[model samples]
Target: MTAFEATRAWAEAQDAADPLRAFRDEFHIPAHAGADTLYFCGNSLGLQPKGVRAAIEAELSDWAELAVEAHFRGRLPWMHYHEYVRDAMAEVVGARPHEVVAMNSLGANLHLMMVSFYRPTAERSAILMEAGAFPTDRYALESQVRFHGFDPSRDLIELQPDGPGGTLSMTAIERAIAEHGHRVALILLPGVQYRTGQVFDLEAIVRLGHAQGCVVGFDLAHAVGNLPLALHDAGPDFAVWCTYKYLNAGPGAVAGAFVHERHARADLPRFAGWWGHDKSTRFQMGPHFSPTPGADGWQLSNPPILALAPLRASLNVFTRSGMARLVEKSRRLTAYLDWLIRTRLDDTLDIVTPDDPTQRGAQLSIRVRAGRDAGRSLFEHLERHGVIGDWREPDVIRLSPVPLYNRYADCFGAVEAIEAWVR
Candidate 1:
């Protein structure tokens, strides 16, 4: 029959059998007059988990009763609250407790990382990044380079692909390293290219950069919680990612930093704060800046407990679901979305995300061929009809089927709606 009929049939059957079907109820999906818009923008802001409100209230209650003593009196203890989430975040990023610390915002953490890792000398001062890297990343690197009195045009090396397509081949990246290894001091790439949803080979990039004597770091803004990232195992000198994306932390949640064990003991200098100082003697209010060993030394200030509560709630969801399960469901759900978009939506659509499941996350960036406003029009129309997705730049629309809350039915519903509009 029609695409609508086919999509409905597939959705019904898949929902009946999905193992994660119950999880849909765990989140309060946005609803309109007729239906719940298939929310696919979790790549940007995650759906608030039902437990988040309760978690925050607990912290609020403890503060009301215990005052400053809440630091020592609460069940979780505000005094050592940041540490509570460190181990869980370490697990999420595949880092050791000492290798990962949740702190600061994405750009701030990137700058802090550069202060220690991007120690460009007079001779080797170039910082390498991709041409279409996230605007935040580009700006951060630009500022860091200039902070060291280096010119952006001369000191920053952007390794742009030779073509219009999304990802740069590993060969081209290596070649850039070979040619500029002498001048290059650091290489930064997104774990998943935000605009294209193209996953980079972190281990491979790490190996090549270290071989060239250049320190490597990853901007996992679109990668962490979207896919499995063995940050410590990837062997990058440092990496930073925001939690709001796939981690499902609330808006402007805390970002995390990963520094490989090799640099744990190094005299590499960083812009330090009181929290980064030795926790054991922090109460002593000492004058010396003795940093805590490992990634804990990266913390600049005491994190806000209220901001972290949502992450703690969200991480519990992940703790139960586990990375392996999340990755498996991510592949299948994304594959189903791809299948529906291609198999149902006619020739009017072009998917920029890689077809290889292992080479991408749940996001599929679609470039509509139906003229200039086609993508925007479709996005607005979909929102009107209760099918949510995000539009980027001039023509691309990013639809991320977050496995934690997204379902097979949502995937089918998105394509069915798109098919109706294209008609």
Candidate 2:
């Protein structure tokens, strides 16, 4: 057999040996002709669980039969729909239910969090973020600083990479904190950076920020369901993440926010909408703005149950698997990917993410050496060959092997594809 045929046979044999191979049946894997597509884009849009279709259809039925009454009378009443998700979301982030709430989209939620936490005094008005954070986050921080009358060009402190195409150094991070911590109102970072896949030490950052009186928050768009997170223990003033990525929720699903319990009754300033009102008196609807107790107080509008439905379906599986066991699987799966890449693809590729599993999730960033079109070229190559991965601008390709649905053989196949492409 040719190398490609041998590779295919190897994939089959490994799949046959996989313990989690059955979980693939839980998803409707995309197919063309008789073969399944090799899907690694779960870092961007996770494949739908077979159960999600039915969960969503059930909502549609309730909508058809009950109409607006679905708000209060459906099987899962819309009036308290967000409640159904509260505990599960809390579990995903390791927070108490009261400290967590499903709200707007990721960017919108970040802005809401900013309004409540990014209180800049003239003396400490700068915002600190890693250079090359997700564009949305950079835009969010810029607008936030400018809105508060600070000049982003100077006040938005971006910690650039320490050397030529190298990662950010912990020493540099701490030095910046020590030098500018007093002049910074907030420190914003991704729990797992989108481009480089670098995982920040949230607790260490938070502890340091608090010592310097700087509020810390995370754009967990990449970290939420990918790794083990204890948002409460991390003690960030706030955090926001979307559900579409690792949670297997549908595209544009509602996002979640973690507001530490200390913020629960602190009279923190917020930009509120009707949904943030006290549930007990929400129907009372007189002329007064009474707030819900915790993270719910940060909400601005009613949730989209259509969006919530898939998240619910995904969370049910997570609840069953338990975060601890799933994280164990994630570590091994990503470790195997790292091992394969280092062992096979390193000569032609630069692995940009951190070397430590404790410093990343499932996504591995590959910097192809074939020039500016490398990201796009490699992306198309993978797709045409039936391997899927996400690409960032310039020359970075990201592959994530998700815990719930990814198999050990999938890891090996992806690495083989990368090696084949490079050679």
Candidate 3:
């Protein structure tokens, strides 16, 4: 173990000095058995913000009172509902307002982006992705290749990581693109890996793919609000992310997409819908489809006002706290958690997440090595003791202490629980 001392007094002192500590009260932490659970699973599903209840209720009230007129007359009119989330979402992802849009769920948005960006020719007809990607991304990419009348096993190029549960090196990715870029029509990778919590070099990957003539995209489900992104500057063809995790929206919340301004023109072949049509001409019910400029042109239907309201509430919190401050606190919290695990629980566990703050997000994937049951037993032990980290399939316990709500004391209590259980 290292020389770091994570004592209770030290934890309390750190919590006292933390500028973001007051924001913790804005969330509703769940109770396990009777007491409040430590709740360290924000990477999976975030705790609900206190404002979410009123936001949902407001939409419900408006719907009840106005009926169809709610589209135009409600406090937040449904006709232009998605517009409210645009600037906030753009700020979160570091995109231009015209380049980002709140739209369908993550997977759906990925498929929709692929529809416009995954065009393949006989000479360039393959897709390159990380080996062992999130199952949904693998499935979507595979189905996309099949739809293009190509064989997944033959046409999908995969770059292997440095080692099992390790980071994918930029050199390996560049080498893969150099070898297969001619045949690769698209390059799709995650900004932050879901299982290992590795943050990829998004700007480098985009540059390499473009130099090799491949349309690049990112599935930022783990990266969006967790990391400060510059999607417009990095300039991927498109990117997609869900709002439920770091964004603190409820389950199945509305997802978002970024389409580079380069593709905002009418010439792009997209599946058009009435909602994506020009708003002024849309009410006229024209015979032909004329898309709204930029990312909004990708919309398929009107948004769910109730579902979007929670995001509006949550984004307000983000706007107030600011991403830069949140990231600074996130790095400190994860570093403390890492230090505690190394110094206190060294014999029983190993952290799979990257040590460098630049190479990962808030999640720490701890691999259990001892005890009655390898992973699940320890996970259950933590839960029974009022700690609420989640267990991944084979042997990983994922704990994400969100900067907005988690405290140094929470980290201390979590490590103390492990120490008690292990002893």
* TM-score to native of every candidate shown: 0.96, 0.94, 0.97
**Candidate 1 residue 306 C-alpha distance from true site, Å:** 0.5
Candidate 1 Cα RMSD (Å): 2.3
Q: Which RMSD values do the candidates have, in order?
A: 2.3, 3.2, 1.9
Q: Could you arrange the candidates by lDDT from highest to lowest?
A: 3, 1, 2
Residue clash pairs of candidate 3 = none
Among these predictions, the greatest lDDT belongs to: 3
Q: Which residue segments of model 1 deviate by more than 4 Å?
A: 1-6, 162-164
TM-score of 2: 0.94
Tens-digit lDDT track of model 3 for 131-167: 8798889999999999999999989988888854666
lDDT of 2 by residue, 216-304 (tens): 99999989888889999889989999999988888898888999999898888888778998888887877777788899998878888
Report how far off residue 129 is in candidate 3 (Å). Answer: 0.9
Whole-model Cα lDDT of every candidate shown, in order: 0.86, 0.84, 0.90
In model 3, which range of ten residues has the least summed lDDT? 1-10
Which ten-residue region of model 1 has the weakest summed lDDT? 1-10
Which is superior by TM-score, 2 or 3? 3
TM-score of 1: 0.96
> 27, model 1: CA deviation in Å?
1.3
